[model samples]
Target: MTKAKVGIIFGGKSAEHEVSLQSAKNIVDAIDKDKYDVVLLGIDKDGKWHLNDQSSYLLNEENPKLIQLNKTNKGVAIVPGEVTDQLVNLSGSEALGQLDVVFPILHGTLGEDGSIQGMLRLANLPFVGTGVLGSAVSMDKDIAKRLLKEAGISVAKSVTLTKNKRDQINYEEVKTKLGLPMFIKPANQGSSVGVSKVRNEQEFNAGINDAFLYDHKLLIEETVIGREVECAVLGNENPIASLPGEILPQTDFYSYESKYIDEKGADLAIPADLTDELTKKVQEAAVEVFQSLNCEGLARVDFFLKDDGELVVNEVNTLPGFTRISMYPKLWDISGISYPELINKLIELAIERHQRDLQLKNAVYED
Candidate 1:
């Protein structure tokens, strides 16, 4: 049997570039070599795409901070258009090979915020994770919460602040509205990149500034005191959610450093210590959120399990982390799916979705 060619695109023009590199390395290492011909594509901070060598990129996995798309002089820019999966190299307009499916392991900003997904959709390429609408909606915390609320899902009470209205922010009014110990984060980022837990006026002001550095819009959410739980949702129409996983962050909260940089920053309890009823409820809610957003391929739905056992949707990660120890795969691992198998299943889902979409009557013409 001929192996499928899978393009694993990573390293984006986002703050999570390092995380993307790490995720790409892990996916490349675990993807079944006999089942797929892997292609490594890199996107630099300037958003330039390149055809990268898998092995050479993997070498930077040891110290992801040192990884950059410019590290290799062999630059071949890819322009995603022409309504085909055949990527063209800018150097000579040479064929960069046909791709069966692309697994974009990019976490934040342009990659996960629907920029890359939109480009792939225009190119008519089959790629893993959510479509442009879902990605765009879910990446923006403000819009996602509104949609989730409309879908009858419980989301954190948050006040959206934009760069223009930043000066008008009154700490006292904010404290009275959202209260202290709130979470200030970039409304459009993931992996807790610009997330900060504010306990006092000083931290609240500083957190706002820090969050604004990453994005123009900021979200100040009322802190829900509970265990940070996550559920992995897979498939398209009839998606299934994995067993719940609890995150015990060693730091004040699950910050970017806690998520990727620090080794002992957080601990995961797969199959979180929740009663069967609560677990089922969470899983059901996760699937609901997934379907509500029209997410395809896979997504990791985060939630806060309160002391009274109520589950509030934190946010939906359309393209969550894929490292071996990441919650998405870890929850599935305990739920009877291996890491490699999970990767394969995602690719299959992407292809299935593409095929299904292609069958739709998309055009009308006069005979």
Candidate 2:
């Protein structure tokens, strides 16, 4: 039997570029070599794609903050509208070989915001994670909350603001509405890149400025007093939710540094201590959120499990972090799936979804 060639695309123009590099490295290492052939596709901070060598693709591989994609002269470009899954070399205009499927280990902005997914769709290639619409909807916190709320799922109370409304932002007004110790974050960013926990007027003013640095739109959310719990969902039509995991943040919150940089920043509680009833509720809610957002393949549904036994949806990560300590894979790992097995399952899911999509009609014929 011929092994499937898997293209693992990582790094991006987003602030989470370093995080993506880390994820790609882990996937490349853990992926079953006997069943699949791995290809390294790295994207730089400037948004250029390159055919990276798997062994030496990352610089400072041990340090999360310092880790980065090693610059490569072998640039690559996707040939859209082609079903062959071929990537072209920029310099010589040569074929970079065909891939059976692509695993985009990218996080935030262009990678997770439907941009790369749309490009892959145009190329008629199968890629891991959610589709374009699902990716777009899940990446934007503001839009995601609205949809979840409409679907009868509880989400954090948040006020969305665009760049044009910057002047209209009144610290006192927002403080009164959201109360003290609110969370300010970019609407479209992940890994808590520009997230800030502001407790006073001064912090609120500063947080607003900081969040806007990442995206034109921002979200001011009322801080929920609850434990941070997450559930990982897998599959397409009949998706299943894994056992919930808890994040014990050592810092004020799960900041970017705590998530990626600091080794002891947070303690992960796999299969979080919860009553069977509460676990069932969370699992059910997670699957509902996945289906509600039309998410296929996989997603990590974050929630604030209130002391009163209420589960408020925080946000949905379509392409959640796959870092060694990342919650998405860890949760599944505790739920009977190993790291390598999880990677294989994701690729299978991607191919499954692509085959289903191929059966859809793209045009109407006039008789």
Candidate 3:
């Protein structure tokens, strides 16, 4: 059987660009070479897409640095055609070939926020991760929390502040409402970018200002005192949850620096020391959050397991980091799925979901 061509797209115009590069590098290394032919695509900070060589793509592997798009590499121009001729060189000199499936290893912003997914949908191509609606809703913390709350899921009490209402915010009132040690974050970012822990009014104001720099909407969530646990969910429908993992952050919280840059940022405890009953509860809640948000392909559902055994949904990451040290794959690895196997399963899930979607009547009028 001929190997399927898998396009691994990464390095997006987002705060998590570095994280995305790291993920793509790891994915390229672990993907089954016998089963799939890999194609590397990079989106630069300026949002231009280029087809990069394998050596150029894995430039960051040795030192574990962020890889940037090599401007000299052939530019990729989407031809907007049938499945066989979508991706081609901008000069139109080379067809570059077609992709059987695309694994977008990008995180945050335009990459994970449904823009690329929308483009893939228009191109009639199958790609990994959530669909447009799921990606959009999951990227926005405000919307995700609201939907999760409406679904009878417990979430941290929080308030959403938009740039227009910046001046109207009463810090004292916010303090009274959400209390101290608040978690301030950009509503649409991931990998903990522009996220801060505010203990006093000074930090609260600064955190909000910093968060607004990344996004117009900011979320101020009351601190939930519990173990920071996460569960990985996979599949389009009837998703299965991996054994929970606990994050032991060396920093005050899991900051961006701690997550990607810092060497001693955090430690993971797979199958987190929870009772069998509590473990089941966490897994069940993870699946609920995944389905509630209409997530497909895969997602990492974070939760706060309180001392009293209350499982509070933290957030759902539709395109969770796929770095070697990332929690999503690590949890699944502990649950008997190897790294390569996990990658294969995700790609299969994407294709399976696409085939299922093809069965539905998509056009409004019959031809």
Find the candidate with the highest TM-score and give its number. Answer: 2
Model 2 C-alpha lDDT per residue in residues 1-367, reported as the tens digit of each score: 8999999899989999988988988898899999999988999988888898877899999888789889899999889865563789999998877888999988999988899999899888999999999999999898898899899889888899999989998888888898988999999999898999998888888999999999999999999999999999999989999999999999989988888888799999999999999999999999999999989999999999999999999889998888888999999999999999999999999999999998998889945
Give the clash count for each candidate. Answer: 0, 0, 0
Name the TM-score of candidate 1: 0.95
Query: What pairs collide in candidate 3?
Result: none
Off by over 4 Å in 2: none
Please give the CA lDDT of all the candidate structures. 0.86, 0.91, 0.88
| lDDT over C-alpha atoms for residue 154 of model 1 | 88
Model 2, poorest ten-residue lDDT window? 78-87
Q: What RMSD does model 3 have? A: 1.4
- lDDT by residue (1-367, candidate 1, tens digit) is 9999898889888998888888887888889999999988888777777777765765446764565554565565545664442777776777666778889899998887898898778777899999999999999999999998998888888899999998899888888998878999899999898888888989988999999999999999998888899999999888999999999999878877777777688988888998899999999989999988778889999999988988899999999987645788889999999889999999999999999989988669745
Arranged by TM-score, best first: 2, 3, 1
Clashing pairs in 1: none
Q: Which candidate is the best by lDDT?
A: 2
Candidate 3 wrong stretches, greater than 4 Å:
64-67
TM-scores of all candidate predictions against the true structure: 0.95, 0.98, 0.97
Task: Name the better of 1 and 2 by lDDT.
Answer: 2
